[model samples]
Target: MREIDVFIDTEEIADFFYQELIKRGFIPAEDEIRELADITFEYLLKKDIIAEEWDE
Candidate 1:
């Protein structure tokens, strides 16, 4: 199998969502935004779209 390294800036992603929501006039809470981001990451991980890195 081929492997690739991916760097994800989760904070940046959350910030982007927050900004978009604000522009739409739906101001979401910080925790809500974070939870949404977590759910997204979890879905991607489950589908093998992304992998969690282990620290040795």
Candidate 2:
């Protein structure tokens, strides 16, 4: 088991990723955080994390 912690200036986006992570049961390592942050939002959008016009 790994304990992952992320600190970013963007709160909303961070929270978004946190929820996505929880839903997917992902606990990314510190090194992977940056890469995850870079792509998680777009990934979630494509995956329909939220039902919005942009995603539809």
Candidate 3:
């Protein structure tokens, strides 16, 4: 069997989350959303669910 890899853009995810927050009437700073997105990514990394690219 071949293993498939997936990649996720944290910045794009942050932007989408920010927009959703605004639509739901929650006001959050852009940096705050970015930080949250980073944290989420880190958690996934720690759980071995995602891998970070260091050769970019």
Candidate 4:
């Protein structure tokens, strides 16, 4: 998984990344976005960078 530390440090960055993913057609729908968020959350959890689920 891609490192999520930068995005975790800034909500704006996370939003920007999400937008880019959509713009690039990497994520096609809200569900995919949620899935990506889940993956990122798991990654963060593994790194112990975040403990709680993100309010998606």
How far out, in Å, is residue 5 in model 1?
A: 1.3
How does model 3 fare in lDDT? 0.89
Cα lDDT tens digits, model 1, 1-56, are 88889876678778888999999999899999998888877888999899898779
Which RMSD does model 4 reach against the true structure?
7.2
List candidate 2 stretches off by more than 4 Å.
1-9, 29-56
For 1-56, candidate 3 gives per-residue lDDT tens digits of 56678888899889989999999999999899999899988999999888787865
Give each model a TM-score. Answer: 0.81, 0.34, 0.80, 0.49
Ranking by lDDT: 3, 1, 4, 2
lDDT of 4 by residue, 1-56 (tens): 77564345444445666799878877556666566666776797798877664666
Tell me which of candidates 1 and 2 scores higher on lDDT: 1
Prediction 1 global C-alpha lDDT: 0.87
Residue-level error in angstroms, candidate 2, position 35 = 6.7
lDDT of 4 at 20: 90
Clashing pairs in 2: none
Model 3 regions lying over 4 Å from their true place = none
Sort by TM-score, best first: 1, 3, 4, 2
Backbone clashes in model 2 = 0
Candidate 2 lands at a TM-score of 0.34
